[model samples]
Target chain A: MTKAVSSQPKTKRGIERRAKILAAAEQVIGEKGFAAASIADITRAADTASGTFYIYFSGKDVLFRELVEDMGRATRSQAAERIATAANRLEAERAGLEAYLIVVRDRPMQYRIVEEARFVDPDAYRTYYSEFGKAYADQLQQAAERGEISAGDAEVRAWALMGIAKTLGERFVLWEEGEVDIERVVAEAHQFICNGLAP
Target chain B: MTKAVSSQPKTKRGIERRAKILAAAEQVIGEKGFAAASIADITRAADTASGTFYIYFSGKDVLFRELVEDMGRATRSQAAERIATAANRLEAERAGLEAYLIVVRDRPMQYRIVEEARFVDPDAYRTYYSEFGKAYADQLQQAAERGEISAGDAEVRAWALMGIAKTLGERFVLWEEGEVDIERVVAEAHQFICNGLAP
Candidate 1:
């Protein structure tokens, strides 16, 4: 994958234009998929000249990586804010799951784009999840140490929790045509997470 | 998606040939992905003439769907057999998860092909998971009635458990370079499933 050389915008106009192209790319690629979507299509969606795309991204691949990276940043920051206000690790999990579902519901395209990254740009896909997994494992480890939760394999628990959130977000939020009952879904799942199936 | 109308082969030899082609397609498509794996490549891998492929499958798409469908059948049968031996839902969950991980380890290609179905054939992907999720929810409901497991919302808990198995299989079995410690991973995750993170 060719890395984009132009990292920063020199002026306000340049910054806005770059952001415009990235946003357009996300929509175009997310809908049409990475293979079918063309740079021309993205430029058309952005209402910008085809040449202007090069001014920001070297090519479509760079813009895709950036989009995936941007989603990671956006979700992590959002979850971090919600989690920080929680009383403990279990509460943090609830807050984080709710925040994640909201993000998926609001920006369904971003979720599609990230999933498409698995096939379009394998490295970016791996990096995105690996980084998230690392941070999640760290938090779980700390919680276990503090006796906030039952101790087990932090890495396994982290991945398991991530899996639950991801699958639920896909099945309930993204795929559902009608408005999903996010509150009810979260509350039920939270119960399971707090206390397992043992009667 | 154009559905293939070809019926089963009449002769014993013809049946074996068709089976060989499907096996080859699994390996070829699983390794090279759907877009990159051509019909010719699959035929070559099967050691059959390219024309023989058409005799069995209308095209690559039909063959791909068949492969995915075959995997679902294989997994469900295997899990059902193992789960039957379990005493209750918790034991069933342990057996089911263990069975799933073993399948991933033994037939990693089938796992990859199923995931690739999301992009290659979206409907098949949805049907695969939807059917699994519905059955899982039913099982959970029954278990709750029998006092096998404490269930709050069967659908929510079913999806959560599925998610845990899916992600763990991906990270620990499919992606691991070294031998995966299946016993240890299952034991740790099972503990979490039986008793949640509550202190």
Candidate 2:
């Protein structure tokens, strides 16, 4: 895993403090919620002083928004990489579905937090949804052009597919605690997306 | 619309109070969220006495639960009707999609509330998701057995299709307004479920 090097490179201590604060923020916000989570609680969780917290985050909301964005960006980047190598639409779609399953399965807490924050704050929701959504759509459009899917509307199809992958990932992979056949579920999702159930 | 007719009939005054309280509960909860919405604010919104609020609901959480159930039941009944009328598997699948789209578009606020409550309240989310999900799957199973879908797992197919429909309905129809063509979107959703996008 790459160390998240902050653009504003302060001292090594500063980077470590920010990472500590963000880790604490994810735990606090996920357990309680964005609305109820406070800077005091976050700092307490991180074992950092309140003053140190303000140095990294402007406020609780700002911290939570960054947390949401980071999670979203991470998930999309992973999915983008998995599908990036596919030569055709069907293969790309399959890779994309499998990638999503892997991402949500591996990082359930971070993923759920991103989704919950969607309703807790609309501004954050739009930023995350469109940013990730457009990237996901770009993959779909490439697949569509490869003659993998009968082309009509790439944007609509991409968003629609993103919704399906998201819902299924949340239900079967993220929310469920027990082991799931992720490969089977991914195949099922790919099949459902590529070919409707019609015989 | 039908008059207030529960299994046990209430006085006209009692019924009106219930309606007013429910309406107020929706607004307050929608704006303020489940945790922060207080009895006083809810009653104030309805113009009813705070004491009278308890006459209809045991408390705020109870009212919220009932509000969710009522919306779910209403939507489910409509979907059930549409699914029942279809003679073939394709028709059944198409009707089911149309039924969902109509209910979601017709009652977006209630739909959003139900979806949000699912994230906020786990038990309610499970109950509602399982019930409606099973209902949609049952319809899909009939179609699959009749050779509407390829010879694959019906349950997985059902959930996949439902996932697709749900993602489209919740994300596009309810969340993204004017971003998608309703008819085309519906057609594409059905295609993904029945034929998939694959050429």
Candidate 3:
């Protein structure tokens, strides 16, 4: 395994350059995929000299791994922020699902990068979801104890809920033709999440 | 997109040869991924000459598309069989989820190949899930009419349910370290599916 490079850059100029390269990388790699997207392409897209790429990272592999990790953090933080305002676990589920769908719509490249990681960097992909799953399960467990939700296996429920958000995002938001009605998807999916299919 | 090869075999021997090639392709392609696994690798695994591979398929891309289609059919058929005996749509959902988890466990290669298709053959991946989603939504719509399940957006519900099964399969079965207690996972997930998290 290639040891991933540091995302942190020291100087403000260095930081801006690094951020540019990272943003360019997400565009290049997400569009062209990890194997096909070359460092030169990324650096070119970043409008930097080819050598500037290595100043921030080791290689494409390391940068791809970082993208996967970055996506995980961004998504989790976004969902947490949305869920923070919810009145209860049920409402939190609704807010979290809505936040996820919106993120997929707004930052489509992040979703592509993370999906690509399943093949490009299996460990990073696993870590990304596993970390998110663990955190989600912990919250679910607490919610169950508080009588905010039904008691069930937190781990299984967490993964299942993650699955719901994921597939719905893919189908309703990403694959939807013409104008996307994310609010409608969130409402319908949230009802299923809270009440399920029981009449 | 390269036109996918015909999965249908003309003769008995042709059927056997094609099946051999597909089974070996699944093993090779699933293990090594689409790009890394060559027609030579697949033929070698099949114990057939490289020239023989051309008879069954044009190239790796065509064969991969076929594999994705095959996986979709196999999973849908298996789930349908299981759901046939279910007393209601809710029961069908349980049987279907269980059936899906078992397929992922037993035919782990198919799961890997389909995931690979997200990058390798985006159209096939979309078609694969969309076809399944449409049929699933149709079932949910009918079930709602019969009052077997709650009235909701069937399309939204179908994809959400599929998302649950897909993620749970990835986490609990395909990624499991050892002996898998699939029944337990199914029970836990099905409970949430039918009743959701509302206390």
Model 2 Cα shift for residue B178 (angstroms): 3.5
- Whole-model lDDT for model 1 versus the true structure? 0.89
In every candidate, how many clashes are there? Answer: 0, 10, 0
Task: List residue ranges in candidate 1 displaced over 4 A.
Answer: A1-6, B1-3
iRMSD per prediction, in order: 0.8, 2.1, 0.6
Which lDDT tens digits does candidate 1 get at residues B90-133?
99999999999988888889998898898889999999999999
> Residue-wise lDDT of candidate 3 within A80-186, one digit each (tens)?
89988899999999988888888899878889999988888898889889988999999999999999999999999999999998999898888889689989999
Q: Return the TM-score for candidate 2, rounded to 2 decimals.
A: 0.88
DockQ of 1: 0.87
DockQ of each: 0.87, 0.55, 0.93
Q: Compose the digit string of candidate 3's lDDT tens values, residues B72-128.
A: 878888888998899999999999999999889889999999988989999999999
TM-score for every candidate vs. truth?
A: 0.97, 0.88, 0.97
lDDT of each: 0.89, 0.73, 0.90
Model 2 CAPRI quality: medium
